[model samples]
Target: MKTTRLAAVAIIANLAFATGTLAQDKELGEAVTIELNAVKSNEGGCTLTFLVANGHASQIEKVVYETVLFDSAGQVDRLTLFDFGTLPPGRPRVRQFSVPGIACDALSQVLINGAHTCEAPDLTDGACETGLILKTRTKIEVTG
Candidate 1:
């Protein structure tokens, strides 16, 4: 009887682990990656087009893309946000943002808000903020 119970418990544990692993894999596969293509310098402001690709198993609804610009002095000069409603699975979306008074060389960092929470990261005591004005690709999971 003891051996039989232990066997049953072991099987249950194995099944649970497998299920968790599969769920994690699915979530990871459903993430969306954003790639910065080009930043055009206009006379009035800067135009940025970021390529966003969704790999989720399901469609993401009501997605908002925001681009926060930081200057060379590490201060936020402009914040431009765009709302791109629904993004179907395996589709690429282009989001544009215009930042006024943002010079090409003066830019130090850019933040692509995927969740749209707009939570400010702690930047105190010489600690670097979450993102800086540089060309980098980051993934924001909109939906699972």
Candidate 2:
């Protein structure tokens, strides 16, 4: 009888822990989402497209990231700042950058090295890094 009670308590504790974890996961998913939407190669160069969404309560006036581009062989091609201007709350925006010399197929990874600018009146100091989610729809991988 004592063993049965202990088992029941253990099950209840496990269920509570699982519930808390699920809530945390859901909250994290609702944060800022940066998706590498597409990459196009033209005569000039390769244009990389990003789909950015702000899930915060306040609007971001400007946010820039020091981005690193990697070649197909995992070598660093170049580093540039991408200014995703004026991200409104709960809205998705598309931003594009053109590289004059890099081919679209040559890029295998993109990394958000750090935030160069994150301007918002009401946001925290580390607002740009907090709960940021990175995704990629193309073959190239993206990481923060």
Candidate 3:
């Protein structure tokens, strides 16, 4: 009886530790993913489409990311901020930015410099950047 009780306690303790580890992993995996979806060049300039998804439980009222555009020659083309306003939890949003005087083919990579703004009532500071994920469906490489 004593051995059985000790084994049961050990099992329970192991389960508790495993449960806590799983929760931490889940929290770390929950993040905002930004995907560079597409790029189109028109008579004016270029239009870049982005797919933004919020995986957090809280709603983000406003969020802006400073982005650096790199040319095909590996030179900085321009730096600007892209505002992804009102990101609801678990909802993917599409946003577009028009870059005047730059062709889509001229761009080679886009670097997410940092978060310019992250506004949410329930989120702590730096919440937008702490677990941010970057992706790209286009030929251009995206990095944070």
Model 1 lDDT at residue 64: 59
Which residue pairs in candidate 3 have backbone atoms (N, alpha carbon, C) closer than 3 angstroms, thus clashing?
A: none
TM-score of model number 1: 0.55
Candidate 3 is scored at a TM of 0.79
Candidate 1 lDDT over residue span 52-79, tens digit each: 5555555565555565667777777666
Model 1 segments beyond 4 Å from truth? 1-28, 117-144
- What is the C-alpha lDDT profile of model 3 across 10-106, one tens digit per residue? 9667545543443344443557888787788988799998877777889999999999999999999999999989988766677899999999999
**TM-scores for all candidates?**
0.55, 0.79, 0.79
After superposition on all C-alphas, the RMSD of every candidate to the true structure, in Å, is 18.1, 13.9, 15.1
Off by over 4 Å in 2: 1-30
Minimum summed lDDT over a 10-residue window in model 1 is located at 125-134
* Alpha carbon deviation, residue 132, candidate 3 (Å): 1.0
Candidate 2 at 107: error in angstroms? Answer: 0.3
Report how far off residue 118 is in candidate 3 (Å): 0.6
| lDDT tens digits, residue span 5-88, model 2 | 998999667545543443344454436778787789988689988877777789989999999999999999999999998988
